[model samples]
Target: MKKYLPLIIAILLLALAYLTGYSKYIGLAWYGKATLIGGAGGIILTLGAYWFDKNRLNITLIALFAITTAVTYYYARIFIDSADFEPTAGFVWYIGYHIGVALFIPTVAYILQKILPQSASIE
Candidate 1:
């Protein structure tokens, strides 16, 4: 269950984003929804990659994630550009940022845990 916590969190985020009407806060119509969905998809894919590779950070996962993200960004341009609200931060940029965090968070957590003096006592 601990290993799958990230996946559970990702699923919950998607639920909250759509089911709770949080997408409306980003923009009107499909723009906000698409961005939130795509971004959540990115997070889910990264965390879910652990099912295939134990190494949360790995070449194959990175490559696959990059390809998927590119495809998502390309297809999302129409709705993103047509957003009713002014897009201050580039839509694709925010999505990529979220994906970037997803890709690296595991390693960061690992490093943080090991860096603490408490790790020595635990080991």
Candidate 2:
């Protein structure tokens, strides 16, 4: 149990931060929701990669995350443009959301690697 304590904690924190609504306070309430949804979709792709022994497919899926993020930004732009609120404010909010998503992903991956160094399965 001691051996996996850190991994467990990290996963718990990830779930709480991403799955729960706590992240809304970070000025990204929508992103918190998007993260939960996007993470779910990512899980499906990742699990498929594992189940089929598809390394290339797994890497491709990871790359697709970045693409999805870019698309998210464009969607945000459209959403903001359509909103009646101050256009600048909406644009800034949308940009911030995408940036948060972009930053959180690599940071989470790095944290996971450090916490589970012996888990070669991450590769």
Q: What is the TM-score of each candidate against the true structure?
A: 0.39, 0.42
Each model's backbone clash number: 0, 0
State candidate 2's TM-score: 0.42
Tens digits of per-residue lDDT for model 1, 1-123: 444444445455545655677745633124554555555555556556565664443554557667757866684765467654346336555655455434433433334333545523122
lDDT of 1 at 105: 37
Q: On residues 69-122, what C-alpha lDDT tens digit does candidate 2 reach at each position?
A: 776777666666765557656665665565555445343443454556544424
* Local distance difference test, candidate 2: 0.52
Candidate 2, residue 28: CA error in Å? 5.2
- The residue pairs in collision within model 2 are none
Q: Give the CA lDDT, 0 to 100, for residue 67 in model 2.
A: 72
